[model samples]
Target: MTTMLGVLLRVYLVLGFALEVQTFVRLYVLSTPIAALTPSLSDPALDNVPAFRRLYAVYCISLGLLRLAAAVDIKNKGLLAALAIVHVVEAAFSIAEVLVFQHVPPQALLDEPHLKTTGFLALLVAQALLFAYGYMTASTIKSKMHEW
Candidate 1:
């Protein structure tokens, strides 16, 4: 049976993909005015750094692929541990960004309280599960051994 963490990891990656699409559209297609793309996609900074935005999108996609790799190789405890840590860190970074940096304007969050709150809740859950499941999973795999 698949673990809940596995399922949620997949969903989170796909969501990351969707978010990348939005960021790409805003930066490339919609021509949303800003420099750096905000974590929430609500506002762009005053910098016109397409390269940074493009690379960030690539980072998201690559992390998704890495998660898939970790999932496929269950015996590789290192990969699983790394995967979990990376995911948790990603979620934490997102939450921190929301707290420390500029997020969607207050009016916007107020306008769609349910949607915003749900998104925030999902991030919190993702962060919790990553740590809870990551090391526990690593413990299940044995390290190298020599048979003589």
Candidate 2:
């Protein structure tokens, strides 16, 4: 179980690093306007650019650090705990955006892309499961440190 959990942590680490790089390129190097991106492609919570940037920074930092720690201490309880906390926050924010802004926005402001409600709901459920998995893995490692 510990080995499996460690593998999962590494996977999360890769995802975190990829997201950080992509966001950095989009926001800084590319100088791409966030609004120009398809609204449906990103979480509507990102509608507020400043807030989104701040939250994204937090996500990137926590994920990068935690993943690196996991690599060093494969069964590190502290790293798992930190990662669980961050994932929970991200999952919540993503879900909230879907719920609060699922509808199409005004055409005058930004053209709303078509959304597959079922697909969106499925994605939300998947995110929730991922968060739960992170929480469980962290707690399990803490409780059964030797086994892991």
- Candidate 2 on 2-116: residue-level lDDT in tens? 5566566566666766666666557555645554432333554455577666555555555666666665564555665565566566556544554566554433222234344
State candidate 2's TM-score. 0.56
TM-score of each: 0.55, 0.56
- Candidate lDDT (C-alpha), each: 0.54, 0.55
* Candidate 2 residue spans exceeding 4 A from truth: 35-55, 102-148
Give candidate 1's whole-model lDDT.
Answer: 0.54
lDDT per residue as tens, model 1, 1-148: 2354444544664565566566656755666553345434344443467786666656655665665565455445676666667767766665555554655444454456536644664665665576456557544332322111
Q: Which portions of model 1 show Cα errors greater than 4 Å? A: 1-39, 103-114, 117-121, 124-128, 139-148
What lDDT, from 0 to 1, does candidate 2 have? 0.55
Question: Model 1, poorest ten-residue lDDT window?
Answer: 139-148
TM-score of 1: 0.55
Report each candidate's C-alpha RMSD, comma-separated, in the order given.
Answer: 6.7, 6.2
